[model samples]
Target: MPVRRFYKLYLSPSRKYVKTLKNLLGFVPGNLSLYRLAFRHKSVAQSVKKGVKNSNERLEFLGDAVLGSVVAEVLFKLYPYKDEGFLTELRSKIVNRANLNQLARKLGFEKLIEYDNRMISATRQGSLLGDAFEALVGAVYLDKGYDFTKNFLINHIIKSHIDIHTLEQTETNFKSKLIEWCQRHGKDIIFEHIPNQEGESTKLFTIVVNVDGEVMGLGKEFSKKHAEKLAAEKACEALGI
Candidate 1:
């Protein structure tokens, strides 16, 4: 494709995205093509050249690294007295899969991703939106620079979206906390999955958390891990730990 014609074709239709990007990032994008590529999920990726993959996966990887570096720096500066372990834990909470997915949804990123039409289910879309968010970070880094990317993350994402205080108080992994409590109190903990007769299509797992031979909590969720986590949360509330 000729450069001028390609620019006209892509730029014309992408005016709305350009405006949206400007509003979101607080800067006009120098390369709109990079942003467009960032929004293209692997499921709908096209081959731009022979034996080459044109998808957001590579960008996602880069973005993940960049995000980690920025977050680490922010945490280090924000909590100067804190130990390395604390900073690492805080960074994990901030960049976890569930948190990123929620952030992407809250920022209206789901509407911007170009994914496979067949995979339009809610769970799939949520995952894609999170990946696209990472890819967008990569695109910002490429279009702007490291310093600009860091500033954008600090000003737009960290200060705007994240509540550090609330995160400090939040228990991201209830199950892990409960396990630690159990270990400290010298109690044996076990999670048992109750079989569901609701057939394969609608099967839901019911998890029972037992501490020292006593059932502490029971919970049901679509996945066993989630069910166990919910049960652990209930157990925590019941035990007041």
Candidate 2:
């Protein structure tokens, strides 16, 4: 090991954390603070500034983007003859909240994450696990680089844990499921197309799902229908449907 990494593993105050990460992630993190921050839930976070808190939300956002890009590339190469729609659906299945939640649990995120137990129940902690997983991805991207992050994701996470062929056979119509649940509950659910931000691409469609006038979920995609489906998938996860 290099001198810096050797110090972090053997002599640093965060040696225990570093060792744990190595066991969990298959590599030692250079920036111990980023990985630590990644596992911190906002419920226990203290505000570092007026409105900013030392939480994993920002890292989650960055990791979401990075994860998407890597997944897209992998799917593209894996299914060269597949159409855009087919690829998109498969990608969504792989990166869905419910799926990521399961993956995180399998990887033992429950032991590493920091949260307020009083505020979040064990059943409701899956989302927190998913968020932490993404935040960890962001930390890896920032600590290493795109190539390293991609390779790590493909080799350590995807190839080891995920079953792509099984996912392809699984049909999860979250949109239909959400609609049926809403009808059964007598809740007014609406899928609305919203205007994009100034810098956002014109070709991209943003769909927001609202239930009883409350925003349930939001999704962005090149196809409006796909965006609505994505939003409904999120809504379904939020409602535990």
Deviation of model 2 at 196, angstroms: 30
Count of backbone clashes for each model? 0, 0
- How many residue-pair clashes does candidate 2 contain? 0
Clash pairs, candidate 1, are: none
lDDT of 1 by residue, 25-126 (tens): 777777888998899987788777785578898899999999999999999999999999999989988987667888988888877888887857643566
- Positional deviation of residue 113's Cα in model 2 after best superposition, in angstroms: 0.5
Residue lDDT tens for model 2, 1-241: 7899899899998899889999999998888889989999999898997889999999999999999999999999999999999999899899987789989999999999999989987657778988999999999999999999999999999999999999999999889989987897789999999998899899999999999999999999999989998999889878876
Name the lDDT of candidate 2: 0.93
> Candidate 1 at residue 25, lDDT?
72
Report lDDT (Cα) of residue 167, candidate 2: 97
Note the residue pairs that clash in candidate 2. Answer: none
lDDT of model 1, residue 99: 77
